[model samples]
Target: MEWLNKDVTIYDLINDHYRLSLWGLRCINIEKTWGLCDEKKLSEVIVGLIDSGVEAEHEDLNGNVIEGYNFIHNSRDTCDEFGHGTNVAGVIAAKKNNGVGIAGVADGVKIVPLKVVNKNGKAHIMDVVRAIYWAIENNVHIINLSMGVEVISSDEMNLVRLAHINALKVAISKAIENSIIIISSAGNNGEDSIDFPASLNSVIAVGSVGVHKVNDTFILEKSEFNNSGKKDIIYAPGEDIYTTFINNTYSHTKGTSIAAGFVTGIVAYMKLIDPKLNQEKAKELIFKSAHIISNHKEEIPFINADNIMISMWREKVNK
Candidate 1:
């Protein structure tokens, strides 16, 4: 609610629940049929959730929430003051097979909460830079950034470049070679270009797509909140999306933020399956496996978790 000003109706919430249920079913079928990754063993990979914070005590997230840090106040508890972080976290690693709430895209993975933004929905470049550096030092496999700045700063851009270089070097060095995948939201500005690091070549920029409730399929039309162009890499369910933890309880919200989180969850799942995969390979796999939907005869690539996992498996077999 901190980021969005609109209110969600009950109808939207029910529709989201329905779509999520279908998505969960598809994921289960994919996993069972292809042996994507051992659900029991996938928790070994630690993914860094860099955002406001996480509702660590949330019933659906408590078990998977591992180590966490608060760069905002430099304290221990990274409890989500704003509900955005919790919603993002839930998308990434909310415990699956619990038969309650909702299933995450990568429920098998572990999360390392990195609180870079404070409760007031504000964050500084220095804190974000520090958080990225900390993630690098801590051996976080994938970093999910659901927040961004209106104007790109030299220092912040430099930090993102540094993180990308370090990740590349680490991948090549073969020493502590964990691929650091950076996923960012393609800001809700609905401009011709995306924002900040997401616009950068190194980060995976995600746009949003609205799905029709009646058929449970992506609405081919793009939302005004979505950012487009070459920088806009992929799209996901972001409009009227129902996620865990509202302002205080639970409700539906919409933005490119959720789309980025959706992609982050898929990336986490990919990492779990092939821990040896490099960042370049991961990025390529995501793009290659995306479901290209046509909007007025124009192809719009959207995130496809099942396709990505299958492609990775196929690559492994071929090799």
Candidate 2:
């Protein structure tokens, strides 16, 4: 019924009977945010998703997305062709309770869809840098980067790669200095190292945690493809995540990219609670409010969205 503006002729809607597949939200304790904080301030938060692009006219994301730029084509047409950005955007701010598709982690948040990657889902590092600068100029509160370059620990970096890396670092620093919260995927290499940008300073790197429920109990496992290290990285539900797709469709995906989306949404919600919540403070709060998932090598932090909101709210009230 509400598919008038969607690009596709036939749009998929989440039926009432089968609307409970959003286990990713449940894994992060997202429902505990009910009656939690200042709901009106949510609209003040804007997340700049630097990826392929977004289907702004999708049935579930129509009103939630705002004007953005496409670096590949050097045009204003930010419609998604690679489909990664749509999925990430849906995870962060898909319309909630409109009785259509699945609910996003955070509600009332607008997304600025910055298309950095091309139609093949490949992007030059300079394009990503440009996107970050654009987000700073637009005054976005949060930036979600679901893409990164893989690096081998033993490999030698050439001058060009090093220059690109430096450019990205400078751009990210500028964003952080402007009080923007940057969340990035911790790569999907399944190695002991995190990828660039995600591994860069002041960026909140997110890894994937596979969630399993058995006999009314929730179990968390580190995803095999998720990059982990001794660095301060947080985990989120990424395996078999259900989210909005291209052409106004809904489907399941899995990766550290999806996990980073969850962190982005939670960080946006935290920003709504405390406008002064910067990158350092957000990382501190996320680490503090997280549920620990440990193994023999390390203790990973699985974010708890409810705890983050409650903590920020309490800080505001006590002040």
Write model 2 residue lDDT over 1-319, tens digit each, in one string: 1111124211122232225777676567765574575555778999999999999999888988999899887889999999999999989988776888877877679899899888888999998999999999999999999998876442578888888888998999999999999999999988888888788758899999876554555467788898877678899989988889999898899999999999998888888777888999999999999977664446778898878888887888899
**TM-score of every candidate:** 0.80, 0.90
Each model's C-alpha lDDT? 0.68, 0.83
lDDT for model 1, on a 0 to 1 scale?
A: 0.68
Identify the candidate with maximal TM-score.
Answer: 2
**Per-residue lDDT of model 1, residues 1-319, tens digit only:** 1111123222222223334433422322234322447777767778788887888778678778877899988887788887788888777776655655765667767888888777888876667777777887888888888876554444766776556544533332331244677888888987776776677676787887765432443344456776665664777777765557844345577788887878887777677777776767777887887767664546777777668877777878998
Residue 217 in model 1: lDDT? 38
Could you tell me which residue pairs clash in candidate 1? none
